[model samples]
Target: MNAVATSSADVDAIAQVVAAVERAQQAKDAEGFLALFHPDALWTTAHGKVLIGLDAIAEFTRAVLPKDDWDGRVTYEVVHTQFLRPDVAAVKVRQVYHGPDGGSEGAPLYVMTKQDNGAWLLHANQNTPVQTD
Candidate 1:
């Protein structure tokens, strides 16, 4: 436990960071997406590929983003957030991919760290596929 954020403004700021992620993804802008991550960030794909560092994430993203022609769109909604410290938070997101066929869901957890400059950077994240029964 670090420091808990007790301000509604902090919550709003965190929400902005989450929204930025969705915006970048929707535009397929690799640079925009990478800007949100810390240099030593970790990312685990929904398919379970673990990526360490921004470089690895950038490589993987560049390869996949350009090739995505799924004829669908993705939406990311912040479902919950918990502050671990004043500078760190865990955020859960509900992701939905709407395609021509139907829609698929994902649950992603993003661990964010607030910088000295008051910017929240993604430190670690994991995207999990939602299995429907």
Candidate 2:
């Protein structure tokens, strides 16, 4: 998705995209989640496989997420929202997770965007491991 628009409506679109992503994750609806990405969107993780394009993202998710059976619950702390234009916005989100395997985790970044169709979608996402030194 090209993030080069400038308007209040664009900002709203981005927010909707963020909400959709969260909903998809909670529902374990990989299709719904992947549908939000562009045809050729790319994703990089802190570790494990790199997902490029919608198909790859779906495949990667199917391969890894099952190992955890995530509880489909997450809490988001939106640090800030930046509008590079209007359609292009990068929202810094911190997500807290409670894994089903009795393990707790958190994702520190979830970027949101507004696509060319004026619909918001998750263009890229990367969850960072918290450092506790």
Candidate 3:
């Protein structure tokens, strides 16, 4: 975690990527969501399923995302961000699903890397369900 000040431009760019994720999830567009990931990205689902690399991630996402039966609207908010380097950031996100039944939440950590082309892509991410006692 770097204590140095991060550029607002970079922060804004990261926020855009997160927003894209929200849009994709809400639309059930697996391809759109996968577009934000790095080629070698690692992802862990809220249920603890691990997906390594874009290929695996894509396979799992394509299989499940579109077919998801949860009739809920999902929202993603970037809660915090720590710059590991100028091109790497660890972002904490607050995820919530508003459904007919009720609302459920997730805490996701997305480690994103800035590409040479000036795009921030998800590198490693973990989605953990926020259980209520």
Best by lDDT: 3
Per-candidate TM equals 0.93, 0.74, 0.95
Question: Candidate 3, residue 126: CA error in Å?
Answer: 0.4
Any runs in candidate 3 off by more than 4 Å, and if so which? none
Q: Which prediction has the highest TM-score against the true structure?
A: 3
Question: What does the lDDT read for residue 34 in candidate 2?
Answer: 77
- RMSD values for the candidates in order, in angstroms, are 1.8, 4.1, 1.3
Q: How many pairs of residues collide in each model?
A: 2, 2, 0
Task: List model 2 lDDT by residue over 1-133, tens digit each.
Answer: 7655467776566666667777877777777777777766677765745787888888887666545555677655566677765555677776666665544455545455555556776676666766545
TM-score: model 2 vs. ground truth: 0.74
Error of 1 at 25 (Å): 1.0
lDDT of 1 by residue, 29-65 (tens): 7789899999999999999999999999999999987
Could you tell me the lDDT of residue 46 within candidate 2? 53
Which candidate model has the greater lDDT, 2 or 3? 3
TM-score: which is higher, 1 or 2? 1
